[model samples]
Target: MNRKTLVLPAVVGLLAPVLAACGGSDSGSGGDDGAIVVGTTDRFTATKDAPAPFDPAYSYDVGTWNVLRQTVQTLMIQPKGDGDPVPEAAQSCGFTDSGNERYACKLRDGLKFSNGDPVTAEDVKFSIDRARSIKADSGVFALLSTIDTVETQGDNEVIFHLKTADATFPFKLSTPVAGIVNPADYDKGKLREGFAIDGSGPYTLKTETDGDAVTKAVFTKNPEYKGVLDVKNEKVDMVSFEDADAMGAALDKGDIDVMTRTMTPEQIKKLSDAAGGNKESLVELAGLEIRYLAFNTSAPTVKTKAVRQAMAQVINRSELVSAVYGTQAEPLYSLVPASVTGHSNSFFNTYGDPDPAKAKALLKEADVSTPVKLTLNYTTDHYGAATKQEFEQLQKQLNASGLFDVTIKGTPWETFVPAERKGQYEVYGMGWFPDFPDADNFLAPFLDKDNFLKSPYKNGDIIDDLIPQSRRVADRLTAAKSLTKIQDIVAQDVPVIPLWQGKQYVASSDDITGTAYVLNSSASLQLWELSRGVSG
Candidate 1:
């Protein structure tokens, strides 16, 4: 596909007063042409700081992507203004055949890594093959299973043979998961090591106090770098913090030039409560994040669709947004977030506004007893500190309705992901960060025969008919038309209840310019868009 402007949902423009008021004051905000220090409370690692902890092949976190995206070049890249996947390292990329199973790309000429190594098609093939071979926990191996083989015609050309038609393949190329790495420097069998990265991009990373999250990280313009982006800053510094409070404190003190995701909901409210500081500094994105409860459909407890729909009907999403998340999120009626092309309010239209009487009546009709016992699971450390309260509110909403014997279970994220995947929970919460911006990412992974939701409920029509048709369409609008039906299908089966969708927020100081344009469609941070103004 050729480069085009990304489509954003109208809801982003129509957010509630709380969120709408928080952003929009800082477009074209000026910054000095100098080094800018970016701070975050989130844990961060350079691609090679402690032996490439943030390597694209092994990374799955926002913080790592925030840094690597500036340095690592992908075949296709998601442009910030328009989240469309545009060519980056490659001159152009698209389907090679009508089957949509074959994909091809030609490399841009004169491309070289910071280390001055020529980037070739063999390296591209190696990088793609290596990501799947390593199969790291955070790797993109699962998504590339459709690729039967990859072949390189010459130094500039690489072609992919897909086992099945996958329309979303181009979007995947925009991610670090498909990041083009140097074959000479990286071992495909073992994860790349050390603070040395052979990257061909706008910036080159060099840590001031390496291996220490609390220290500073520096990214300087790569003189050898060749790409489509213009390097605006002379240098960029990154400071790590433990939580929003700590980062917010530093921002208040003007110790950092820019900060992203720095304020908690309580702190954000305090911006008005205290009525001081750079209020216009906040920027909220129309991001693609969906938080939901994955039901163990095969389990006898939630085996029936009536119980799933009953739970879906009773668990109030508005309350979760207003009370628990505040302006941090909006209620999502569809698994596919509204920010994407093919999103629908199938849940809201199908079952209007959380009706407890109707939910109880439905449960009774299904022969299920009162107070259907269920374990609602979540993680404390993985998502953030706020998730605990969010899950607590869910437990309250369900139990208070007198329809559910809700047990709220909390576990660390590291432990929870595997256990939840093993089908250990009757019902568990799952937050999805998209593999690609496409709406298909929202549905296919959850509904497929072997989905990320291990004990997933199967719908043959979705697996067999809707998704295949959606994936084969090359045009996004055409694909979206097919994908629109997915929400209704999921609502009918109700394997998972779409609870809420979140926005990407960056809380930079008033003078920091790129705060308003930090996120792409896939919700990856675009640090390249950032630049600093002269310190006042």
Candidate 2:
């Protein structure tokens, strides 16, 4: 989880009935056969500043590139509810017998891209190789670090030769970062030049207005998109809003069918009330995305393990959750949220309640006579309604402890990412929406040295012993034991403090049907599974 908190000041008055204004009815939805309208907060704007190319190989924010990847294909996909690999573009994949080092994948017959190009083993090889070589923003490439070389065994089969023996190699392939693209799209050994849409997934980009910059992606049924996506809606019209309020208003006014991200608790409550009586008019799906705070351990003051532990004990997570989110969020004690495999309450076990006495004791043990002053930073609009309040509560709790002085800073995501990456603040708040549904996704990103946070922690036990030992074991139950140990160490060390795990609130119009509310590890909505209900 990234250490950023978003606290939305409650809108004081009750919302009046928003006037419904009918805009241009797109050819898809009800008027046209097999089309659905979806609403989302914030459109990606490159008008003022050109966006980096949308290549899965380097794209770090998985949420932004979700639609594009739906049009593309990956080697494997996580079977719903388990970390086990299920074939998507690949027909079958498994590890070699030599201590889980070598891995091989076989593609299904007659698979082709939207452009009608055959999906050969070379294309799969090119996709994975480019992801590693390009080194784009994606954390997914971190998984490819274990791979030493790629060898193509004919058009249908490919083999991955590994530098490390890891049984979790197949799970990495299940991420969108491993989504397959056309080999011909890129120039010879170049990263930034390729930006064409040529994927073999369930959808194809039908109409995109680059100048106006509103992306209206249309997904037609790919006869070859015979994977696990039980698509109920044939076409999806994704319209973007400037912020969550706009998206919420659109849903209330019946202009859009679905709303995602940036949804506030107030909006969720209203929608929930609306859905209660009218079953056909609305639907809700609660999901698991964890939010937390990260301490830059490399910083001078935070360098002491005692100080880190003290901070964790001082901040009251229960109070933060109640004040910021009300009943919207559940207090999280582990890095792995409750929905994912291998979740354990190690932090809760260690620190039962916020005790100022315990914090002062730890601070004194570190030999800190003067009051420790630290700056806590969080992104303004990223996490949701509860972020700002959560930080404020944290600040109050820490200040009340009398052992520490705290300063809080807030910035927008555009400025926050670079700032946090450069270690601008002593401590910052952030959340992790998983890239895939696995305990490893939670553990790997924050703990891994090269990740976005770039934590300077050098625990040989976690890096060398625990993480590697866990990856070697294929059985999830056995691997979970090692992960539990890692969390226990994290609770003690406090490099990153565990806050609250998120419960997703999605409200859909009564007119929608067949919406399987499966929260993918990324916390992104799977729009293809939704359809128009019998009545709008």
Candidate 3:
């Protein structure tokens, strides 16, 4: 796709308030320049710090890998603003009728990795095999478990032979986990020892400073990139901050052009009000994210179906959304948020409002004693400001039911991720930004047995039969129906209770143009489509 540039005039008007909420301000003028500045809380501080060996094969968490994956091209990529898979590194792909067990991908000719290495069928084979071998924290490999073997068919073609039938196999190929990389950059058999990222995405990491530890990630246009990227700016500057409040303060001072995961509704409103008074300065995007509560079924107390169900019933979703998030978030009941397809109100239909008496009675019937005390943990910097308050409300609601005792704890994302993966906490609050824009993306990660959660939930019928059975059908509606059934089962079992769907909120300087927002499951910013504007 041809690149598009948006230019907003610096004219003063009512647009300022919206711009202010979006992190734009009308201050002593700096004219439209070719650069875009982005502010975010916390940089991915993985042990390996170099950008050359930044292969997705060893990536588990989304923060660092996502930046790398976007820079490096994958075999396939999710379409912009949608969940459907489209071409990326590969030209085209489809399944062979070998009973839906064999899949083939055709790569675009002359495609090259950032290092000038030719992207080949052999590279595809190496990437897939390496991902499975390392089996990093990424859950994408689980989708490949069905693959029997990967063989290069020709210079531009590769085939995946599956041990069982699977139609969703192509979708798996589109995920960031399956991103293509150069085998020459690192040992294909072993994980990279240091922080080096090398791939064929839209950008490259140029310099990383260790003192204040600022990661200066820059995206250079890929000359060999033949995919559908409409990048406008020549380069994107991603600035990492240690604190959300500090990031918000920076945005207010015009030190940052874009701020992620920092602004509160009150703060956004203040910016919007400022923009309204002065036309050339601010922009605001409301409700652009999602957050939820996850139950560690491996925990003894949470393992009991009745206890899980009681906890779900006792949650006051509306109150939680209103009190903690204000108007920035809406009440959510399904694993699939309202913005996506196949979203349902199954949870609301089953359990309406908080009823402590009913919750207590359910626990009693399950032969569980009252005052069920459990510790709840959450990441300190990952979600947002409202996360702690949201969990606190949950503790209060549950405790008020007199059915359980609740304690709350918080940690940073880097520590919380591994701890939760090891099933360290009894219960924890977690948030999922979609890997892809499909309902399947939300359900598969949490419910899939090999996921990072490593949930002990074993529904042979769902995993072994229903899910795989649904994949064979190419129709999304039919696949959605099967997924809906799975959601119902999860709801009844309460492995993870539905919390609230967060709104994507953004503030941009009025001088920046061509910055149309495209919502996705990943919640990633499409830097390619952003550009400096002529006026407000």
Candidate 4:
């Protein structure tokens, strides 16, 4: 998802240097997971699990964005592990006004959709303008809040007028939300007829096979494409599974060349334990994703800061990581990932260790009765299957403190998301998948009134003061000091408790080289970098 700064090496095979970086051979060659047939249940190329809308403007989740990256061309793009927004579809682009509110770009000549429609400035204008207008569930509008108008001048030039002066505007253009779409093929307020896309990307849909509500889409080199990525293979086959089991079975049978995300902790353990299996078929990418418990401040028991702080104080992250997640994830002490700028151990800094006796004293100080009764809510579908055991472990830990009697409840993600948004659960599990690699994304989304968290957290210093101040600075490194303070404040306030950061893994059959090198930081596979190993 050159769409955001992320990694699993969760696209591990994509970062070939990681092995050398991790003390492997210099060429960073994966032995041979490089089979021609690739299989993944990862949502990065989907219309269902993630932001399922296949149209460029409607796709927001990383899975959908990754698929679009192969199918559509944007003005700019972010490469693996790098957040810088660089030229793609545009010959060149730059801000034209002193306010940093006006941007302009020149289209690369001879670009066309797979359908053969000429790509032009009007298509770029329409694509962006429609994304702002449609406002789909994928949450594309959050990234483009500064845009006010898009002006097209002839066939090659396009200019954007923005409502605010944002230096990150160029990075926004690199996303698929701004991928140019042909006006003749798409209508306003409606998605394209089917998920099969028509674009000027390196690959075009060649054939699609559907059965039992799951579809496998095959992409062949787009004859009309004139872009950067060199295609290593003539075709790529991607399939979406009913669930993890279906995908795991395919991998065991060598039905696919590679498998992406959604491997269960148990499944990951099995693969890693196999002899020479990890070295040949897998690469583990330590990730930036955080899994935590959000304490609904409106809930009667946790309404006060003292109660929330007690909950945070009593829980041990190390225990959760080991007992439940195994090697798949590590203990997290900060809201921001260490890979990103402004990552501080604010939570760790605030609370030194899991102090149950101290927790009971704090609850007493807050006038909370002994044996506090509380319910912990979670979703079985969104989080991995290991989540149930994790939450159960959490219940044991909280109960062992002698200050809490914790109850666990489970719901599916589709129902859980809306319910959590409505503040239906007193405390619920939430995972942070950054919209972009910026520390701003990790903080800003939690601060806004209409935030992704959907909570009633209104910290004026964070939401109104620090975040705005942080965004005004163009350089992320310079903004770190300000953003780090934001995390410190959130940690002290305790609207949510930071638990653990995930370690992402990409399992590929050993025949593949470059699987680790091909994924962008977002763990979205650059499927083109993969090639089958030549047999002796």
Q: Which predicted model would earn the best lDDT?
A: 1
Q: For model 2, where is the 10-residue window of minimal lDDT?
A: 1-10
Alpha-carbon lDDT, every model: 0.72, 0.69, 0.67, 0.72
Whose lDDT is higher: candidate 2's or candidate 3's?
2
Tell me model 1's lDDT, rounded to 2 decimals: 0.72
Candidate number with greatest TM-score: 3
lDDT of 2 at 16: 20
Displacement of residue 21 (Cα, Å) in model 3 is 12
When summed lDDT is taken over every stretch of 10 residues in candidate 1, the lowest stretch is 1-10
| Span of ten consecutive residues with least summed lDDT in model 3 | 11-20
Ranking by lDDT: 1, 4, 2, 3
Against the true structure, what is each candidate's TM-score? 0.85, 0.87, 0.88, 0.85
Clashes of each: 10, 20, 57, 26
Candidate 2 lDDT over 340-401, as tens digits, reads 66889988789778888988888788897647888889988667645777788888988888
Checking candidate 1 for backbone clashes, the offending pairs are 31-532, 31-533, 32-532, 32-533, 32-534, 41-241, 47-52, 48-52, 48-194, 51-194
Query: Every model's Cα RMSD, please?
Result: 6.0, 7.2, 5.6, 5.5
* Local lDDT at 26 for model 1: 36
Backbone clashes (count) for model 2:
20
Candidate 3 residues lying further than 4 Å off, grouped into runs, are 1-34, 48-54, 98-100, 211-214, 277-289, 518-521
Cand. 3 Cα-lDDT:
0.67
